[model samples]
Target: MTNINTEVVLRKLLDNIAKEHNYNDPNVSVRAITTDGASYSSMLYAATISTPNKEELQLFAKVANVGEIARSQLLLPLFDIERFAYKELLPAYEKIQDRNKLSNKDRLVWPKFYGCNPNLYEETVVLENLKTKGYVAYDRLKSIDWAYASKAVESLAKFHALSIAYGEENPTQYAELLAKMKFNPDSLNKMAGTFDKLVDMAVAVTKEDNKERLRQYILKESGFKNIDKFYQSTGLIILSHGDYKPSNLMHKTNKDGSIDVIPVDYQTISANSPIKDLYYLIFTGSDEEFRRHHYEQLIDHYYQQLCRALRNLNLDPEKHYPKKNYEKDLKDFMPFGLVLGVLALPVITVEAENAPSLQDENGLNSILTTKTSNLYPERLNGIVNDYVRWGIL
Candidate 1:
């Protein structure tokens, strides 16, 4: 965007923030702040809005991805989903927490929305900048440690709890939101060919005898083709952060030696089995070694946190999501971990230089062809080995 157009948008955003917070005579300064290889779909910026009295407000804005490849990948609808999340879904969640008198620590925390313009290719969503408050994105190249993973799941559980409350408290509105947020399966199916190529590449490196079984499962039985049916199967359904990996979360260490995590990037948000979110976080964010040591523990921690969060909101866990049902869902969705791990590891582990620019027709194809770090194969082998050990392959 030109400087003139950028200034106009920034002024409009600051004016909206002023209207909400009663700022007078605000002056705005903008700067690009996106991390290298941090986001694939949008440009990120940090801005400061100052008043004559010297009061300042820090803000973040996500500009829509502009390219034929990006649009073909359904970036526009994804932006719509994110805007709906900030403008509609999160506000309702906050109201539910406020009505229940939930503590701040127990509530679902997210960036404070300023405003948005959903005008076609000019799409933009603005919100309070958490980075100014010491929050930082986790390094994508590294596996998540237990401390970070635990806090992340805690935050995720609280979010799912609030989603459950929203559905129970306002069934009609919740249904409408679900209808709107249900992502296009065709958009996902577009990547099926890419994953098919990924599967062959994965199998070529497989050392285990059961590698053929892995191929059969992913290609014939458990690929993206079956995702809709799998998610629609009998399970506790809620609004899920569809891309719940480390890169999409921002964290800060507290004085008490605990990490506070907040999830961002709701562009891929959808309504589905809550287990799908858990699988995404674990498979996409952690390696086999981390899973071997803490996988079951993380699952238990998430459930425990979910129960607590639900109780804080005056909901009964046994009535809504019992342990037996959760256990059953885990067994039913077990293959999802392997499938998602194989597909996401490549994208997540690609070096910055090899990352897709999203500026050309072949941008999305870079997901299949990018040169990834050795971590990719090591992690892929780990996931396959785990499945083999568990006899799931």
Candidate 2:
């Protein structure tokens, strides 16, 4: 986007914020606004909300509006999904918990929702600035340690449990909310050119014998043939955070050395097999040693918390979601991660200099050309080898 257009977008966003929070008061304005990683698809702004009394509030604004190119490529109205997650779905879940008398500790995963404008065309959601409280993303190039990985999955458990609780309590409303979650199975088509580019990069870096299998994996319709169905898991479905990468997570290290994980980025969320979230996080976030040695432990950890959450919501875990079902679903849904891994590895491993400026017309093209770190191939290799060993390839 040109500088003039960018400023205009930001200005309209500010106006939205003022209207919602400040009664459109001229006495309130912004001191400064800046962009970050989300500037590609969403306009992320951090600023000081100034009032006539010199009092100020630190806030973050996430805005999404598609141009012609973006509408065709991304395919869905992302702002609508996020707005529904914050405005409707979550609130309903919270209400279910309130009637069950669950405390804050029992219902803790998401951020504080401030306000949102799901205007169909121009969408903006304002939130409390967690940055002001010292929250930050772990280095994207670095693999999360056991501590970080554990907290990250813990949050995922809490999030998925909310959906189950809501569904169990009010089946009708849960069905309605799921209906609003829009998806296009063929939307994956737009990524064809880029997926091919990523495959070439993966093939180039991979060891020889694995290269053919990798190509077949990309070419095979079997791999993603049932993706939309798996994403909309028929029997054991829950709300899966669609893009659950380390970059989408925020953490703040505490005095005791353990970190507090706060999940963000609800734009791509879909109702799916809960294991889909686990696959993206474990494969893309953990190194081989952790997966080989402690992977089962991590799975057990998420289920334990999930069951505890179920009990808190007055549902029996064994009757509602047995441990055996979770184990089976984890391996069954592993194939979906293979497809997601190829797509995510590049973005996960790209450095700032090589990363695409997703704000421009040539932006999608820029992403295809981003340089991949050594980890990209290594991670891609890990997914391919795992799929073959599991007999899915």
Candidate 3:
């Protein structure tokens, strides 16, 4: 067993792997290591390792603990799903590569996964560095463009297709595994107050008629009381990138002037309606005019690509993810767009440094804070107008 407290042991572990991978230069320097969040029972590091040609490769290393917070507080009690994403999820993800029947590859499109090892203290996963690839991070909600949106929609379709294909081919396994999966409503509930605040902002920015309409809809349709019911009844469960926001997607421009969307941070992977991802992406990322102009086209585009992907995976889109089912799911789950907009708009529309931190309880409550004056008037007005125009209010 290696000691967790000793930096030497950790460095040695990284160094040995560097050498084995033909990384030369004989000297390995650990540049920066830091925890990604308080909720995870893991450690993430931004490391620079010497490569064969004496070049430094920036990599991310993830180590899994005995159990993660989600597993303990959410997954175990709800779905009996285990924690330790690096140990559990990574293996399943890697198996997709091993099968070779799918088009998933690590180096070109996806983040490359290096070999994993288990020590007495913890398990470790080494990943190919992404920083050297010129990946840029931008807030999805605020940074919407044709190139970004198109790429994102296409990539998401592929991801959803993979899940549908896997589920169809392995029905028994899919059902069994998903049965243990549970949604942590606690997190949603925790953010309820923030949502309320967002609604109040929306109300203020809207015209009197629209505001009343929104108020009625908020009370009757999208309230916290009925949100869970919507999720439960929606028969559109697929492996959703739970956190399908712009920040989680990385982008790099190719020589041809096209942008590629690379999905990272799979920790929030869950069985949810694909529309949930769509709702989150569009509501948070796109502006009112863009959404108003392209909403129908975008929705149709997403479904079309999703169906194409499902077909590519040899899965019948009609049987599992038909248009009828998608429409029904949208009717029930699309309210999340409004609901999350109320809660997310303040933060999503604000300057990064000025936005409330998720780490603070006060900031958390501010998410539900009913004060509209603190938000950007233009954005809030736009959101209210769009909801009204869509008849969602």
- Residue 245, model 1, lDDT: 92
lDDT against the true structure, per candidate, is 0.82, 0.71, 0.63
Clashing pairs in 3: 79-180, 141-284, 141-285, 193-368, 194-367, 194-368, 197-368, 197-369
Task: Write down the lDDT that model 1 would get.
Answer: 0.82
Regions of model 1 farther than 4 Å from truth = 1-25, 183-189, 208-210
Better of 1 and 3 by lDDT: 1
lDDT of 3 by residue, 34-61 (tens): 3322213345566667655666656766
Better TM-score candidate (1, 3): 1
Rank the models by lDDT, top first.
1, 2, 3
TM-score of 1: 0.92
Query: What TM-score, to 2 decimals, does candidate 2 have?
Result: 0.86
Question: Each prediction's TM-score against the native?
Answer: 0.92, 0.86, 0.76
Residue-level lDDT for 10 in candidate 3: 47
**Stretches of model 2 off by over 4 angstroms after superposition:** 1-8, 11-39, 52-55, 119-121, 217-226, 359-366, 385-393
Give the poorly placed runs of model 3, Cα more than 4 Å off. 1-26, 30-45, 51-56, 61-108, 115-126, 139-141, 184-198, 201-209, 355-376
Which 10 successive residues of model 1 have the least lDDT summed? 1-10
